[model samples]
Target: MQRSYSPSVRRRRLSAQLRRYREQRKLTAAKAGAALGWPQQKISKIESGEQKRLPAAELDKLLDLYEVSGEVEREALHECARLAKERGWWSKYKSAFPGGLPDFEAEASAIRTYEAQVVPGLLQTPDYAAEVFRAYRLLPEGEIAKLVEARMARQGILNKVDPPDFVAVIDEAALLRKVGSAEVMRTQLRHLKHMASRHNVDLHVLPFAAGAHAATSGSFTLMEFPDPLDASLAYVDTPTSTLYLEEEEEVREFASMMSRTQSDALSPIRSLSLIDKIIESSIEE
Candidate 1:
């Protein structure tokens, strides 16, 4: 493929492949480490993607130990390892979220998001984003501006020629909530409608009538890559920390929540109608 896939994703996929091969070979981490003359922690980190980069020599050794077959498979792994070392545009924003959301988002084939209290970062307008940053009052003025800029940059994925299918299930509470002044919200809502017009953007609204639900209490994102070798990821952001769930069992739980949330949300047409109603209201306008 001509596309420049995110290096981080390749690294992750590579790590997963190695882990699978080790298990298939019936080799414990301890046995693998003993054979490779390395510490078990080293193999553990490599398999878990905690290692920043997988050196070529180490990868060769692991493949040989696993008795990996065929030149094509070997070359593919090497290629993935090579791509894994490169950085995406978001590399410069490491200060905001080091090796975080952007790394995964850069090459995602599908992005499923659910928001409760505010607009998803991908859809927030600049002024609206700034107001959101100011809400916490944790960062300095300069930091707020930087974060807004970083957030705006993140939205660029929606504009890509082969952009991920962006699906957002937003609670009605978020639409009614006042983040910034009327003008800022008006612009934000209008932007949402505009984005919804696009082919790849799928927007839905979960109404208050849906009653209390488990998923709506917080927010999360589920990202899926094009390659089946790459497992789905679940992202959760909190006041103090962020979590990236890579394990299939854990990601499945979030995936189930997203499925339930989608079922309760208003359909695309009805979602637009609700948005229009909100826009027509005195507060948002």
Candidate 2:
């Protein structure tokens, strides 16, 4: 079966391609908009992926304006435009995850995550995830259940035939913090060890002894794509809002931070050993 591309990823890929083409032609957004007889705002929106439903005729015109004549390149970009207009599986829970990070995550070639407070969402068990939502948000039971279900569904990506390379560095404090109960935490810790064993997933733990290191502020996920034109995206999920950064410099800084944090963390072998110790402790408690 052919793989389906997420609209979020498609949009971003198309946006970056369009912007690069214009830049190569030595045209600013305003100049490009003027040449195409379009408003500057439309150019900005299209380049930002905010205008998801870009007409093919307009895309063709933009290509013509940018002198993109090669058939192969044109067809690839045409496919991107087509995919951007289509919704992905996560669109069903659009309200709960309005930021579209999940869709980007679904299509990533690699995912680098750093967490200082809690277990990464992709590694969370259902019970542990439920407790996280319950403690952090004041939503009704029905809403919480829906969110939890959506979160679990996100994990399906890990089981794909070609799963992304997953690397996560977690704080020891997150391991010790009790989410639901001792039983819940015990299960969660065991699950972490199991996930760490996966060939594609690399798990590390930052011990408290390695204090005041990189990424001490909070957690963020850095997503990479197979297509170089797609660039990299850094996702920071805060209590109030979710922020996605696409700037080259900002994304580079996050990538650097991941390297630093990983250096400060325990290796996979030792991390699993620490997790086993935590599981035993949780069981005794």
Taking the candidates one at a time, how many backbone clashes does each contain? 0, 0
Please report, as a residue range, the 10-residue window in candidate 1 with the lowest summed lDDT: 1-10
**Model 2 TM-score on a 0 to 1 scale:** 0.96
lDDT of 2 by residue, 148-205 (tens): 8899878888888899999999999999999998889889998998999899999999
Q: All candidates' TM-scores?
A: 0.94, 0.96
Clashing pairs in 2: none
Q: Could you tell me how far off, in angstroms, the CA of residue 19 lies in candidate 1 after the best superposition?
A: 1.3
RMSD of each: 1.9, 1.4
In candidate 1, what are the lDDT values of residues 237-258, reduced to their tens digit? 9877888888889999999999
Which segments of candidate 2 are over 4 A away from where they belong?
none
Error of 1 at 180 (Å): 1.5
CA RMSD (A), model 2: 1.4
